[model samples]
Target: MTEQPNMDAGAATGTKPLAFDRWLEHFRGNPAYHRLIEADIDWNGRSMLDEPTRQAFINSFQRFELGESGDGKRLLSKAALEGDPTYLAALELLVREEQKHSALFRRGLDHLEAPSLEAHWSDAAFTVLRRALGLRTELGLFLIVESVAMGYFTALAERAPDPVLRGIGLRIATDEQDHIRFQIDRLRQGFRNTPRAGRVLIGMAWTVIAGGAAAVLAVDHGPALRACGLSPARYWRQAMVGFRRAAHSVLANPGAEPLGPLGKGVH
Candidate 1:
């Protein structure tokens, strides 16, 4: 947003790529988000209930999916209507994939006999935000949220103990990784086409939204982590290291050359 050098260009020219130092810098400055991932892992491992607690935990987890997928569908529809063809197509694919995720979670909930709540509130929130700030801002918010979710799901997949849960986590993680790539590709194109001032505003908005969401998750899940054998602070440090390594892979990948323009805002 601040017109950083084209970080992906080196990869395009078959040269060594720019490192993810910027992303790591961003992550280090926001331990709150890392804490959320750690707490989720801790909770899933410890507080996730044997049977009675499973209902409540499943309900909460379902609500989270409902909220997230509802927002994703709305954002995708809006993007299809207003964005470029390539971007919109990718977003549509993501939307369909997210629907599958939603259904997958719903199946799990149903198998556990969990109650379903209306997800209209999530849609309402997205609509309000879009009306207030326009499409690009909404997309930025979506991307940041999706990125955090990707990291969370990936970490959970790596730590899950139960075979079924591990399988689900890994599947969701794969979807999330694809979602991240789609968002990165579209956001990069958007940044290239956007006015410098507008890009800055969107980046700032994304940072705020991502940071706020991370804080909320950490607060909600921190106690759960404490209940587990893991310390929240320690788990957070480990997760950050993992996230940094993943970010490095993306930043250094040859295929990510097209994302050069948006590199500054990727973390």
Candidate 2:
């Protein structure tokens, strides 16, 4: 298969807007893209980290795996109500890719001789808070989550002690960025007709949500961040940086560049 999806992960630039249909094609064609990533992660059940660092990473990883391990049934039910066949179909494939992230992390844990966790307070809290906001699936929440993930994985790739974790980070970073932009495009479409003042208000709300999520994650995943040579504060800042870029792309303009990374190969 192709090394990358066949579409740029287009989320409109601050000066333009992105289309949702392109995202559909990207997910449609690359259904099992994780297979490509797996070939490169050849860790045959080896613990590559020292004990102290290994435990920290395992603690953090188990939480991430728990979040990614969903089957998307809840979300698909929501999509069915929305009656958007295209998005529903794309989302089904997207969920598979998200599950792949869990699978990859699970494999890493097994290789490290670690057990996946049954639950995490942060995961539960995030869910509670997300549903607590009663808006049309808000899509902005996905933007916040994936934005954090993209930067978090990049840190793992650059600073983690283990080559296998680094490989998984690098591979998953691509998918996470695409996921971020997918949500961005969807949000952009929803707000395309709103007045500038309304968009600004929405952006402000989004930024606040992003900030809150970033702060909590900084604390929630602090140990792994430290193990990987990234401080919680620094990781939080990096997450905000990505979120701002995405927010501007979605709420700034409808005639600018998109965060298109699918066909172009994600950075």
Candidate 3:
């Protein structure tokens, strides 16, 4: 196992000690998970009158689920192979929950009778990037993905005409919020421990990924937003605000101390 810096609860006098590991473990199976599962809506009866609108939503949802499941599985596998038991455990639970999310999205599509969804990013770019970077880099990417997903789900919940779809979106959005928080915390910690070049790479990668995801949403749901009483400019502005808020929170947090020379020992 990689040696992580042991945080002493009483080290900083007069200040509440930050219990990173404890908090991570505490949120492993958040109540939001159960709530989301329970609140999921059946979308079988609903119909999007426009073919383009229905197709776009189906494509977006499918790609989103595939991306999530792929990322989760990769993270869990890497953590386990690296012998980082704490991260591995956390990711194990997280991946399971993500699988549920993916399954629900898939089921929703089946209800709509949309065509089979294909992987969105099948090129070598993602694979090469993943191989070149470490877990920290992956987490940075995930932070952006989850943050954008939160916005997309929130919009879906507000606009979806079907009660079940709306309920599902709300519940999923809640869980997504928790996921975003967890990822942001992890990114902060990663920034602290990672090398300068690595940190810069992470930041750049996050920006690119965030931008790409946002574009995907815009392309997929532009009309949907209009239908929901939101203009293009308004939806874009709201999305920007949400993304910035999430990014700011991650950047602002003073993270855990770096492992420093101990990082060498881990290798």
Candidate 4:
């Protein structure tokens, strides 16, 4: 895949140039994963979780479900205006995949006999933040969220009592890992030509964002994390580890991090 034109960066900051074609192909080939998760997991049964854990999971995943519910219209508009066509295409698929997550979460809520929230302050905050910034800045914030999500779902996948719920968690976590890399790729390319001083400021901001986000999520999802046998302290630690891995990789001079594999059929 050819290196697409840059937004501000002269070339990709990463040693590996941007390959939006492969990214697009990767997104296109991954839809089957969601379908497999849906088919293999029986999402129609009632939760077998203990009373406290059951309600906690319902509340927590519901919030996350709402987080994934946004339609991404503004995001797509920004992508079209300033990003590579191939990236915009890949991003559209990414947004659709997030929507699929919402559907899966909705099904999970029904299975747990819980009603989904009509609104959430956390979801509203994320919407406002993304809309408040440029595409690059939005992506930076998005990367933090995705990185944190990887930790949250991984906890559940490994520790949640319900096997079906664990299945859902693992599938979502798998997708989030890819999503984090996608954002990192875009960010490295976007910021490649940024002056060292500007990079410093950006890195500082990301550090604060990463720290604050981990704390807030730990508090908000404390019950669910505890139910999954992950303490808030441990969850925060894991979240920060993932966050630093993503943030540093993006803030680095030339990312040597390899792009994840081509999806099943995209190779």
Candidate 5:
């Protein structure tokens, strides 16, 4: 068997981070990609489920919908300040895509005859955290959400008894996989020029932040997760895999090979 290299190896020994010019093109393509998905959305689809499952989804998605409803002005302003118009325009499209997610969830709630909530403590806390931080820090926190979404939505898509709900979950989860890649690419650019020691420190801090977020997500959404046949431990484990992978991209050499395409549908 091939022995794995040390997990704690620092990024200082690697070549310079890859140029982000390619991401500009990728981001440019994203708006059209999003439009294609948007066109196919079936808002009138109904979700049929048991009472317990339905309530669990309602409670969980209400909070998630609120979280997704941010205006993203701060993120846009920060992106503009980066002096990359291509990146800034792409960020605008990304924000619109996220907004569509909120709308989709809201429409799902409507289909189930469940009320969508206007606020949640978890959403409030995240908003405050993002508002108090710089772009890099905010992106780090946002990454935790994407990581959790990967696990949570995958479970929902697989196990939800309602076919419409399953379809919605699968779509959102697919988009989330790409979102993780997008965020990591930008984060790698942010840390590209930092000293090795600084990179290590940032990595350590990000691990703590990501782990905490995962723990909180499990606690906050345990009921819905359980209803979807996912344990909190399993959810946290999957989220950590995503977080660690993203952190590695930023803190170490990602290698020459592409991360490549995500699997079709839910994993």
Candidate 6:
């Protein structure tokens, strides 16, 4: 695989190059792993499914592909202002990985003869909301989406009737797990300096946001979740697990070991 052009590398700051040095190293090294995944995974496998299952996947995956296609221009600008060169580099790499996911989903859609939308109402709404807030608040909202994605993909991987869809979902789920960890780490760093009262207020606000997001996902993608043998209630519960984990990581103890898969391999 060809390397992506490096984003402008700014000078490092503070005693440590980045507060999340370990995560930065992992991000820098992930492209090789991603390339191996791209080479090894069979994106072209034909689905052997009944009409309902097939239709559900087509509906679900296309929307997900569009959501993954964002350029992250705002996120890049926000991170650039943080004065942490390593963190900015990691974020850039993160954006690239998401683009790769978008590409994978698009290819899968082409194979299935499904059309991906140029824009989704949900995507447009999310972009607008994210841009309206500062980086911290934006990340709070981002964590909510990541949480829902984690649940959705995990369900698809475990329950999709088509072997091909299951394989694709599994790969994406693996990536999402890593993404969740990265988000937690960055959120931890971002909130490290907040006072107790401030942390409390942020946590309260995030809880409300996460609840709303979970409800929206449950309603928006209920059919897809049902196809994967999950109830909307169950899916919402899984999303909450991710939400609480992120909140605990940020407000309680940023250095704590994660509650679930560290998905981030330590080199």
Candidate number achieving the greatest lDDT relative to the actual structure = 4
Provide backbone clash counts, one per model: 0, 19, 1, 0, 0, 0
Better of 1 and 2 by lDDT: 2
Model 1 clash tally, residue pairs: 0
lDDT tens digits, residue span 28-130, model 2? 7664565666677777747657888888888778888998987767666665554456667887888888898898889778877889998888778777765
What do the candidate models score in CA lDDT, each in turn? 0.48, 0.72, 0.57, 0.78, 0.72, 0.72
**Against the correct fold, how does model 6 do in TM-score?**
0.85
Per-candidate RMSD, Å: 10.8, 7.0, 8.3, 4.4, 6.5, 6.3
Show the colliding residue pairs in model 6. Answer: none
lDDT per residue as tens, model 1, 70-182: 53555655655542444455555556556666765665555456766675454466557655544555555556556645544544455543333444555566556545554
Tens digit per residue, CA lDDT, model 6, 68-182:
9989998889778766777778778878888988887887777677889788788888889889877766776787788766788888778966666665677677777777777
Of 1 and 6, the candidate ahead on lDDT is 6
Runs of candidate 1 exceeding 4 Å displacement: 1-49, 52-56, 71-77, 81-83, 119-127, 193-202, 221-256, 259-267
lDDT score, candidate 1: 0.48
Error of 6 at 201 (Å): 1.6
Taking all chains together, the TM-score of candidate 3 against the true structure is 0.72
**Candidates' TM-scores?**
0.60, 0.84, 0.72, 0.90, 0.83, 0.85
RMSD of 4: 4.4
Tens-digit lDDT track for model 3 on 1-267?
122232222332334333346434544546554654555555555665467666656766666556555545566655555444564566566666677677667766676576545555532355556665557566665666677656667766777655655555665676666666666665565444445555445456556677776666676566665555556567666666666666666654436442111110001
Clashing pairs in 3: 41-164
**TM-score ranking, best first:** 4, 6, 2, 5, 3, 1
When sorted by lDDT, best at the front, the candidate numbers are 4, 2, 5, 6, 3, 1
